[model samples]
Target: MSSEQRVLHTPDPAERENLATFLSRALRLDQAAVVRLRKRGSSLVSAWVATGFETLAVRTITAELGVDDVTVGADTVLAGLRTGHPVDLGYSMDSAWRGALPPMDGFAHVDDVPARALVELAERGADLAREHGGVHGPPASLLDQSVLTVTGADDLEVQVPMRVVFALTAMDFIPHAGEKAEARRIQPTELVRVRATRTWLRLDARYGSVARRLGGGIPLSPS
Candidate 1:
């Protein structure tokens, strides 16, 4: 399959409920009340529905785990550019989404392929949402992301390079009514943080083995 043709599944009821509960707890809102609020006209499943909110979550999670800044691959960069969207990769769900970026200037840059792919995704998502007038059907959607990063080494003093994936979704938990025309489409974007100790150098030897073992890197050859 083409890299741009990534599959993003819908969220199940259980997933929605978990997200709702998590939001309620994080925002200190009553679970039942939160659910009700979510069901209200023009609403979001979680208070963290804003586009930037996801980016914030990514940065925070990465830092907390003591991982360096995240980097985007050529595919990601190209995807975003093509689709007018930004996102984390598929493997992120299992790998904790923290070590996605490869270190560079204390931050990570988007890979060419994914950046362009996002542009197409953005267009598709926006078009789809526009068609429904901002009402997503029963099942919610997801967008996964994989990133590259540089890790700190204990003895060699050479930062170990790595790639990680963080998955994201573009979902409409509750169908909102009277939402502004702009609110119908969720724009794709990215947030990069600086705090690593390496520069641009695809040390595939160093990271390739680790990525393969960790199940994060894309298969060099299609299966």
Candidate 2:
């Protein structure tokens, strides 16, 4: 992987002001604008302002560029777009991201695991749940939630609702609430045992989009 990346396009304060003005004027005509970045070769990038989805007015804003660090900015921008949140283009474009591997707190050494491997395990758990054919349930109550304790390399006891297990396992970091306010990296290990009182899974409302896209409704509650 390239150590550095470049940002092809980002809005500046003046550009934002211009956009706001344009939007105010264009709203009278029922039109909108979108900004896009087009990459050209390894060292060239261009920016374009399209009016109502037009595709021929993009211009190269920056000169031929060398490698630059832009991953965090790009990811933050994408996330903002995905969540329909406002983005501080200035900060995102100028700020530097922290190192890739930050310290992992709250988790035991066994929780140190590769993100890819963890995702794979979650996928496998989901597959198992599908094969078993069970009804989905709501999230477990905090006081009665299942717990998985790990010490070393041992057979994992998979007793929790497969959906919950899959969601938890798929997370890159698990955040904790309290005075400390820290997150822990999930370490991958085989030595673990799960104790779950519930046997059924729950389709979280958040997965509604996935269900809709898959042409299926959330599973009905078990009778």
Candidate 3:
């Protein structure tokens, strides 16, 4: 068997700003307009956002804006785009992300911005967006009132009620350094739920999108 090891890279202040620039160009938003983000419980929750506007543009923008570390796949996407290749902006996000991983604080300083970073950021953003699916299509909205059921083999089912008001879909789930191994999925319509005691009558997962896109934009099914 031919197996390879994956090594992770740490994101520095320069790279973080570069990523922000790439994201701004990729999403066609001003860098000043974009907000720096931190991952909420392994994934970037929508509540962490300043606005209720939920789109892959928002999600991926936040994902790349992360300062702690960058995913190899994301780097590859950026590199490919820089070289002018087809890329897919499509990725997946998961609930219960911090269920197993260690706690990590926010990226670097909040207000830090590097000079001459937009050029590299734009280049990387174009490279990464080449084959990304969400770049062309409408972005995924945040889940309003979704039910995540835990149905194991032998017809054992446990439904968890959840309410997700602010959250990203796929893009945010990519650079979650922790829980990568245990983060497995099964059924398209199935997902793990995160309910808010502060808010009532809310669901964060979707069966319709899963049915339409299959594994593409479907919810996460736990292992």
Best by lDDT: 2
Task: Return the TM-score for candidate 1, rounded to 2 decimals.
Answer: 0.19
Clashes of 1: 56
- What's the CA error at residue 193 for candidate 1, in Å? 15
Candidate 3 stretches greater than 4 Å from native: 1-33, 36-145, 149-167, 175-197, 200-223
Worst lDDT 10-window in candidate 1: 57-66
> CA lDDT, every prediction?
0.25, 0.29, 0.26
Worst 10 residues of 2 by lDDT: 206-215
Q: How much does candidate 3 score in TM-score?
A: 0.22
RMSD of 3: 18.7
lDDT of 2 by residue, 89-129 (tens): 33323222111211112222222223334345555544554
Q: Model 3: which ten-residue window has the lowest total lDDT?
A: 207-216
Cα deviation at 193, candidate 3, in Å, is: 8.7
Ranking by lDDT, best first?
2, 3, 1
Q: Would you estimate the TM-scores of all the predictions?
A: 0.19, 0.22, 0.22
Residues 1-223 of candidate 1: C-alpha lDDT, one tens digit per residue? 2323232211344433343333433233211211111111222221121121122111111101111222223233223223323222222222222323332123232222222232244445545545653343211332222233333334312221111111122222211234421224423232111232333222111001011112223323311
